[model samples]
Target: MRNRRPVGIWLTTVLLSSGTLLLSALLAGFLAVVSFRHGWVRTSPLYGIIAFLLVSAIIGTLLSAFFSKKVLNPLIALIKATQQVAEGNFDVRLEPRSKGEVGELIRNFNRMAEELSHTEMLRSDFVNNISHEIRTPVAAIENCATLLISGQLSGAEQREYAEMIADGARRLSTLSRNVLSLSRLENQGIITERRRFRLDEQIRQAVVLLEPKWAEKRLELDIELSEVTYEGNPELMIQVWINLLENAIKFSNAGGPLIVRLSEAGGEALTTIEDRGVGMPEEVVGRIFEKFYQGNPSRAAEGNGLGLALVKRIVELSGGRVGVESRPGEGSRFSVSLPMENC
Candidate 1:
C-alpha cells in the first residue's frame, strides 16, 4: 500500500468543517443570550424570528468573505493562469500563497509552466537550426548550378563547380536521411528484429567503412575487441557504431591516435571510443545529446547536430545508455554500455 500524505484534501475538509461548527455555536449562543435577556415567555415569536434571521445573515456573510479569500481567490488565479497557458504564454507562473491543496496546485502549475517554457525554447532553436542547415546547402547547389549553366568557365573550373554541386547535394541528402531516421527512432519504444550477431565484427566493419575519412587525416587506429555476441537490432546498432566512429574521426587531430575498445562486464557490453581531438568543457558535454545542439561552433560545418542525438535515442531504445567524459584540449572518450541479454 502507498503511504499517502494527509494534506491537501484532508486539510481543506477540516478547515471547512471547523468553520461551520464554530458558526453554528455562535448562532446558538446569540439566540440563547436574546432569550435570557428578554424573557422567553414575554418576547414575541416574530421578534425571535427576526433576530434569528439577522444573525444568520450576518454570520453567513462573514463566513462567505473568509472562505472566498482563503479558497476562491487562489482558484480564480489558477483559472486565469490556465487561460494564459492555453494562449501560449508558457512564462506565466503562480505564487503559492495558500497552504494544503491550493498551495500544492500552485507549485505544480509553476513547474508545468517552467517545463513548457523550456520545451518551447528548444522547439524554436530546432526550427532555426534546421532551416539554416537546409538553406546553406540548397543555396550552394543553386549557385553552383547557375555558374555551370553560364558556360563562361574553363574545363577545370567547370569540373570544380560540378564537384561543389555534388558535395552540396550529398550534404542535403545526408541531412534529410538523418532527420527522418531520428524522427522514426524517436517514435520507437523498442528495438525490433533482434538477433545474435558479433558486436566486435560490427564495430570493426564501421571503422573499415570510414577508412577513407580517417586515412585522409592520417589518424592512427588502436582497436581492442573482446569477442561478444549480442542480440538486438543489427541495423540500428550498426548506425550507433558508425556515428560514434565518424564523430571521433571528424574531431581527431591529424595523425592523432584514435582508440576503440570493447569488453564485457557484469552482463553488459561496454564499448569506448576515445579520440585525441578537441575535447569539450563540462557544459558542452551535458547538452551534447540534445537535438540540434553543437558544442563547437568552429566545427559545426562538418556535420549537422543530429548525429549524437540519434545515437542517444538508438542506444536508449536498445535498452542501453551512452555517456562521454572529456576536458578541454585533453581529448574526449565516449562510452556505451549495452545489456548482453535480450532487453
Candidate 2:
C-alpha cells in the first residue's frame, strides 16, 4: 500500500487550520454583534486583524507539515533498511530511486551484503577441508583392517599387513588428538600459576621422560643448559620440551645427535631443540600448526601429527611462542620462548 502519512498529515493540517479560521470568523462575528451593541474596540477593525492571523496560521501550518513528512520519510526508510542489514538479512534493498545521502547509504549496504555472502562461501570451504582431512585417515584404516582380516598369508606377510594396520590406526589417533586440542585451545580458558624454579631442570625432566624412546633409536643428547633458571608453568613447559625433543628424536637419523640448549634471549627464557633429522618442506612448514595436518605423509614418523601443533598451543597458552628453522638435508631447530622470572 502507498504511504498515506504525508496525505493524512496534510489533510489534518488543512482541517485544523480551517477550523481555527472558521472559529476566528465566528468569534469576529460574535464580537461584531456584541461590540456593535456594547460599543467596545471598534468591531470592524478587530474582525479584520483576527481574519488575517487565522489565514496566516493556516498557510504556515500546512506548509510545515508537508515539508516535515517529505524530509522524514526517506530517513525512516533508511533506518529500517539498516536494521535489517545489522540483523544479517542482506537481501533487503532500498529502491535505487531514492536520492542523495539516503541513496548512497543503500548502495553501500548492498556492497556490504555482497562481501558477507563471499565470506560465508569461504567458511563453507573450510568446513569441507576439515571433513576431507578426517575422511582420508578413516578410509585408510578401514581398508587396511579389511585386508588383514580376509587374508590367507604366511607369517612375514601377516606381520607386514599388521604393521600397515597399526600405522593407519596411529595416524587416525593423531588426527583425532590434533582436532581435539585445536578445539580446546580455541575455547578452553588458560590457567597459569607461576612459582620460582630452575628452567633447565624442566628441560632435563622432559629429556628423562623421553629417554626410553631415544634409547630405542640409539639417539644421543647434546644438552647445553648448565645454569639457566627461571619460573613458569612447569607442567606445560614440560610438554613443550617433550614435544620438541621427541620430534627431534623421531626425525633424527639413526645414531644422530639431538642438541637441546636453554639460555637467556633478552629477558625471555629461550630453549632450542636441534636435531640432525629429516627436515620439513616449505609447504608443510607453512601449515605445520594446522589441525590434522601431517607434514610428512610417508608414515616414517610415529606421531599422530598433533605433537608440534600441541607444542605451539601449549607454548602460547603459557604466554610463549614456538618457531622452527629447517631444510631438506639439514636438521630442524624448534625454538621456544617464554617469559622469565628472576630466581
lDDT of prediction 2? 0.73
How do the predictions measure up, each by TM-score? Answer: 0.83, 0.60
Write out the backbone clash pairs for model 2: 174-304
RMSD of each: 6.8, 8.1
Residue 252 shift from truth in candidate 2, angstroms: 3.2
Instruction: Give the alpha carbon lDDT tens digit for every residue of 1-343 in model 1.
Output: 3333435644665676567656765675678567857787356655665666567756765785677567767877887788788889999998998899889999999999999999899789878888999998899899999999999999999999999899989999999899899989988889888899999999999999999999999999999999999999899899999999998998889999999999999999999999989888999999999887889898887889889999999999988999999988889999999988862
Lowest lDDT block of 10, candidate 1: 1-10
Model 2 is weakest, by summed lDDT over 10 consecutive residues, at 1-10
Candidate 2, 182-297: lDDT as tens digits: 66766756736766678888888889999998999898878899567766666656767887887888889989999989888677888889988898778878887764467777
Judging by TM-score against the true structure, name the best candidate.
1
Candidate 1, residue 227: lDDT: 94
